[model samples]
Each structure stands twice: as structure tokens, then as C-alpha cells.
Target: MTEPQAREIIENYLEGYNLFDVAGMLSCLHPAVVFENVTDGSVTLRTNGKDAFEAQATKALALFMERNQSILAICLNADCARVDIKYFAISAIDWPNGLKAGAILQLTGQSVFTFRDGLIASIQDIS
Candidate 1:
């Protein structure tokens, strides 16, 4: 797809995500969408298809009281777009990892997106 088209799709998805709106996010993804999360050079999570992705997104919706990912930059290639983002959030509750409720979390990350039929087909998030 073209750059602007791809960017608009990505921005739409992110807008849904930042609002914890799973339905809106899923509207921008292909039916067979695949999602992966990588941390410290290792893949920590993988979800296939829109259903699985929706489930994960729903679960994550409760992880933070407020969260946002501000796009820092976006670069386009033949069939993929990479987005650099700054993530900030306030924990909604205590976590097993010792992150307590009300704690502030911040990080920088990149998300690589690929599209199919004008919708996002795959996503790899790295941090």
C-alpha cells in the first residue's frame, strides 16, 4: 500500500488503542492479523488472528489507569512501516512484578506494521 494510506491506518489503530477501544482497533486490522511483542531481544508474546488480538487487548485494557503512546517518528518501506513511540502509563493495580498501583511507567519502543488488503495484517512491537 502507499505511505499515506498505511500511515492513516496506523494512526487510526493507535487512536483506538490509546482510548482502550478494542473494537475501533480491530476495525483497522485484517481478519488474520498477527501480533507479537518482543522485549530484550526475545519474543515474549504472540497472538494470531483478530480474535486472539482482541482478547489480549481486552486484558491489557485493565493494566493501566491511563496510558498513551506518542508517535516520535514513522518510517515507511516497501510493505512495512516502523513507528518509534514514547509510552507512558499509570498502573491501575498492583502487579506480580512489584509494580504497584498508581506507579508511573515510561518507555520507548518501536512497532513494525505490515498491511494486507488495506488493513494491518501483522504487527511486531519491540522494546
Candidate 2:
């Protein structure tokens, strides 16, 4: 796909995620996909295929009592992209993890996405 088309596809995918629409988010991934989440100093959550990835997403959703994740900006390169996301994730209702009310945890992270045939073939993230 063209760069603009890929950007739109990614934007839509991000929008779907912020809305907690799992199905919508999964639609952007290829059948044979590799998703890597590198957080907490090099441990990776790797999933093969869309189904596996969806399962991981579901687990993450279950952990949150409330969450609102937003994409601040997106920059697309040749077959790669970076997105700045802002999010508010709460583990449980009325359980404060030292976060203030209405506080947005600003995350300036980047993910490299490789597309094959207009679908995401690989996604590697770092914060």
C-alpha cells in the first residue's frame, strides 16, 4: 500500500484501540503476524498470528478497570512508523497507584511496523 494509505490504516487501527474495539484493531493485522511488546527492560510479549495477538489484547483489557488510550501523533516512514500515545490506565476502580485524578500518563514511545501486502507483518515497540 502507499504510504498515505498505510498511515490511514494505522490511524484507524489506533482509533479502534483507543475505543477498546478489539475486533477493529485485529482487522489491521495479517494472518501471520509478529507483535512484540518490549516493556520493563527487555522482556517481550511476543505473539504469532492475529488470533494470538487478540488473546494478548484481551488479557490486557481484563486487567484494567478503566482505561483511555489516545494517539497523539503518528509519523509514517517507508514501511515503518512511530506513534506518540497518551493514556490513562487504572488497574482497579478507586485503587490509586499514586496517580492523580484525571492524570494522563504521557508516553512518548515508538513502534516499528512492517507491512506486507497492506497488512501488518511485524510490530516492535519500545517506550
Candidate 3:
């Protein structure tokens, strides 16, 4: 796909993610896609395939009562894209101590995605 096409795909995926629509977000990933997260300064999360990614999302959805994410920007190349996202979270279902009853934590993060055949083959998140 061209650079423009890759940008559009990434933009659409970001929009879906902001909505917390797991299925919509998953549609952008290839069947054999792997997603990794490096939040704790270490790459710990590894979702080997789409199914595994969905399982993680399921657990997250059940854990958080409310969530909102917004895309700050997107940089796209021929076969890759990076998106900056700002998010707000309210984990009412499992609120830990030190946080108020309905605490909103604002977070800024970035996601890098490598595309193959117009679909995401790999995604790595840095927060």
C-alpha cells in the first residue's frame, strides 16, 4: 500500500481504539500479527496472534469501567506508522488504593505498527 493508504489505516485503527471497540481495532491487525507492549521500560507484553490480543482486551474491558483515548498525531511511512495517543482511564471495577473512587489518570503513549498487505503485521506500544 502507499503511504497515504497506510496513514488512513492507522488513523482508522486509532479512532476505533479511542472508542474502545475491541473488534474494530482487531480488524486492522493481520491474523498472524504480534503486539508487544513496553510500558515498564521492559518489553513484557507479547500477544502472539489476534486471538491472544482479543483475550487480553477482554480482560482489560472487564477490569476498567470507563476509558477514553485520543490520537495526538500519526506519522506514516511506506510500510509503517506511529501514532501518539492520550488517554483517560477510570477503573471502577477494580479500583486500587491511593486512587479516589473515580480517578481519571491522563496518560500519553505512542504505538508503532508495521504493515503487510495493508494490514498490521506487528504493533509495539511505548508508554
Candidate RMSDs in order: 0.7, 3.4, 2.1
| lDDT of candidate 3 over 14-71, digit per residue (tens) | 6676677888888888988998999868997899989998888767766556777677
Q: Flag the better candidate by TM-score, 1 or 3.
A: 1
Candidates sorted on TM-score, descending: 1, 3, 2
All candidates: TM-score = 0.97, 0.78, 0.84
In model 3, the Cα lDDT at residue 33 comes to 90
lDDT of 3 at 54: 87
Q: What TM-score number comes out for model 1?
A: 0.97
Clashing pairs in 1: none
Any runs in candidate 3 off by more than 4 Å, and if so which?
Answer: 95-101
- Backbone-clash count (model 1): 0
Candidate that beats the other on TM-score, 1 or 2, i.e. the better one: 1
Better of 1 and 3 by lDDT: 1
Candidate 1: stretches off by over 4 Å: none
Best prediction by TM-score:
1
Ten contiguous residues with the weakest lDDT in model 1? 61-70
lDDT tens digits, residue span 43-112, model 1: 9999999999999999999889999988999999878999998999999999999999999999999999
